[model samples]
Target: TETLTNRDNHNYDDVMDFYLMDNGPNVTGYVNKGFDVHLDDFYNNLTADKKSSFFLTALHESQHTMGLQHPFESGFDEWVHNSKIDSTGSSIMSYNERDFNGNNDLRIYDLAVLHYRYGVNPNARSGDDTYGFKNFEQNNADGGVYIWDGAGVDTFDASNEKDGNGVYVNLTAGSRIYRGGNTIPNWTNKHLGLQEINGS
Candidate 1:
C-alpha cells in the first residue's frame, strides 16, 4: 500500500529527509497519506521542540489529504484575509504554526469538524467549559454553601449551614444548590450553569 523511504542514507542533513509513496506513485520528499507523519530533522538536525512542531505540522497537512480544505484557503480571498487570526488558533487548517505561542491546542469546534469529517474526534473535550471537570455535583440546597443559583439574593450564612463553611453565592440564572437527592426551589433552568453571560 504505502511506503516511507528516506531521501538519502545520510543522517546529518537538515534539507530533505524522507518521502512517502503509494504503489503506483513516485517517491518524494514530503509526506503523502493523511496518517503518514514525519518530523523534519526529527532526530538529528532539529531540536526536541522543533521536532514536536513539525509533528504538528504533519498532522495538519495530513488533514489536508483527507479532503478538507484550509478555512482560509476557500475562494473568498477577502474573507480569508479579513478573518481573525485567532480563529485559526483552534483550527488545524488555519495555516498557523502549532507551537506553544500559537493557539496550538485544538478546540471543540475542531473536534466536531473532525468527527463530522472522519468519524473520529481528536479533541473531544478541547473547548469544554466545565473547568476541565467531567461533571459537577452539588452538596447543599437553599442558602447553604453551594453553587450560586442565578436568581437569588442570599448571603453566605455559615451559622445555618452544615460543616460551618460559607457558601459561594451567584446571582445569575440556573445556579444549582442541591442537598441530598433533592434540588432546591427556584433553580430549575435547564440552561442554568450551561449558558455563560457576557461580562457577568
Candidate 2:
C-alpha cells in the first residue's frame, strides 16, 4: 500500500494508492484490487462521530483487495440476521450503522474473513487489555469489536456502565455484548485470555 502525497505526479501502475478527492455522492472511499484506495473529500466534512475517519475508510477499502464483499452484496443477510450479527454494525465493509455510530476495529465478520484468509494472528492485542465503555470509546470502537488477544490477563469490565443491566456478557467469539447502551458484537477468547467479566 502506498500513501501518495503528490497526487499531481503519482503513478497508478503497480501500487495501491490512497488519497482524498471529491469522488461522488455517498461514496467515502473505494479500492481497486486492494491496490488503489480513494477517499472522498466528504470525509473531511462530516462530524467525527459520523465519519469513522480516513484511516477506517482506508481499512474498509483495503479489505476489498482481499476479495471481501458487503454482507448485503454477498447475499448473507439471512445468515447475518439468523446469527444475530449486524454486518453494518460489526463489519467495516457495510455502508451503514446500527449501534452507537461507527467502529474502529475489524469487528466480527471482518475478523472471520481475515482469519480464514491468513489464519489468526496470535499476537493481536497481546497485553493486559480491558473491554468496556470507556475503553471502547477511547479507541473509537463504537460500532463493535472482536478481541483477539495473544497473551496476558485480559478483562471485560462493564461494571462502570450504568445502562448495562440486560447486557449479555459472553466469553465466546462472535457473541453480542452491550456497550454504550447498545447491544453490539464483541467476542473474546475467555479460555485463552480474559479471566473475568465484571458486569453491572
Candidate 3:
C-alpha cells in the first residue's frame, strides 16, 4: 500500500492504488495517474452509492488500464470523442451521478466503444465474455433496460418487477447467466435459481 502511493520513475510503471486529495465532490476514484494504474481515495466518502460507486470506480480505472478513454475525451489518432449520453450521463467514466441498479454499470454506449476499440474478450471470471457484464435491470429515465455487456448484442422480454413478474427466459449467445428457474437447474453456470426468480 505504501509503495503504490509513492510514485517515481522506479515504481511509476507498476499498478498503483492512490489516495487523491483533490478530486471533485462527485469524483470518487481514478484508475491511472500519470500512466500508472491507481485507485483514488474518493471511494471512502460514498454515502448512498457506496457499493455502486466502489465497483464503478474500479471498472473506470480498469478501462484506463485497457487503453480506453472517456467518449468526451480525446482518443487515438488524436480524434475527439463525444460519447456522453445526453439523457443521463452517469456512466462510470463520467462525472455524473453513478447509478445503483442491479449493478452500477457502464453505459450501453460505452461498452460499444470498448467493443469497437478492443473487440470482445471471452472467458471472463464471471458473467458474459464482454468483461463479466450480465443482464440487470437499469432504472433510469433514459429507457436503458440493458448494460451493453462485453458480449455481443443480446435482448430479452422482461420486467423490472422485484416479484419476478416480467423475467425473460430467452437469452442470446455469449450471455453467461448466474441464475435460472426451477426447471432450468444448472447451478455451476446459472447464478440465479428459479424459485428465487418466482419470488418464493
Candidate 4:
C-alpha cells in the first residue's frame, strides 16, 4: 500500500488533470498512498452541518484509492438521484447529498461500494441496512449561510428559505454549489465546497 502525504505548497505547475501511472504518486502534507484529506479554508468555510457533509465526502474519495466508482445506476444523471437505500433520500452517491458527511450513519451501499472496490466481499447488505444520521438535512433557505470565519460564504441558498440557522440560502435553481466560489466541478460533476483555512 502507498502512504499519503501533504502537498499544500507543492505546485503541480502545468500537470494535466489525470495522470496515467501503474503506481500512485507521492503527496506532501499527507501520508503516502493514503488519501490527503485536505482541511483547507474551503472545508472550514462550511457550516457545521455542511462540514459534516464534506467529511463524509472525503471518506468517499479516500475509498476511491481502493478502486470504486460511483455506484452503478440505470439513468444517466437520474440514476444517482434515484438510487436510494430505501427510496427515502439521496444515496451517498447521489448529487443532492454528495456534500453530506455524517460518519455515524455511514450507509451499507457506501460500504459495499468500498468493499467492491477493495475486492473484499462483505455481505451485500449486512446488519442494520439503516445507518448514519437521518436528522441531518441540507438547509434550503435563501441568501448565504456562514460556513467558517475567514473562509467566507460556502453555499448560496437561492431558495429564499431559512436553513435552520438565521442565514438565508444562496443556492440557485440550476446553479451548482461550490466552496470559495471555485468554479471547477468535483466528483460526479459536483462542486468542492471546502476552502483552505490559513494557518490551520
Q: Give the TM-score of each candidate.
A: 0.38, 0.50, 0.38, 0.31
| TM-score winner | 2
The parts of candidate 2 lying over 4 Å away from their true place are: 1-15, 44-54, 75-77, 80-83, 125-200
Expressed as tens digits, the lDDT of each residue in 1-200 for candidate 2 is 44332213433345656778988988877776637788887776788666656667788888776546766543453445532344445567766665535456666566655553444455876789887643333233332344555566889987776754555677665455555445564343221111111110
CA-lDDT, candidates in order = 0.37, 0.57, 0.42, 0.33
Candidate 1 regions off by >4 Å? 1-43, 75-78, 85-87, 97-105, 120-200
Candidate 4: stretches off by over 4 Å: 1-40, 72-81, 85-91, 98-105, 116-200
Return the top candidate by lDDT: 2
Task: Kindly list the per-residue Cα lDDT of model 3 for residues 46-161, writing each as its tens digit.
Answer: 67657565676677776665444553443211222322332124344554443344445556545544443444454422352322224443554212433334444444433343
Query: Residue pairs in steric clash, candidate 2?
Result: 16-35, 34-65
- Looking at candidate 3, the ten consecutive residues that score lowest on lDDT are 188-197
Local lDDT at 112 for model 4? 32
lDDT of 4 by residue, 1-200 (tens): 33322223332232112222223233211112433333233554568877765555555444443333354333234344333322213234443443432333434344333322232323433333322112334331111211211122233333443344332223332223343333443333221111121121
Return whichever of 1 and 4 wins on TM-score.
1
**Whole-model lDDT for model 1 versus the true structure?**
0.37
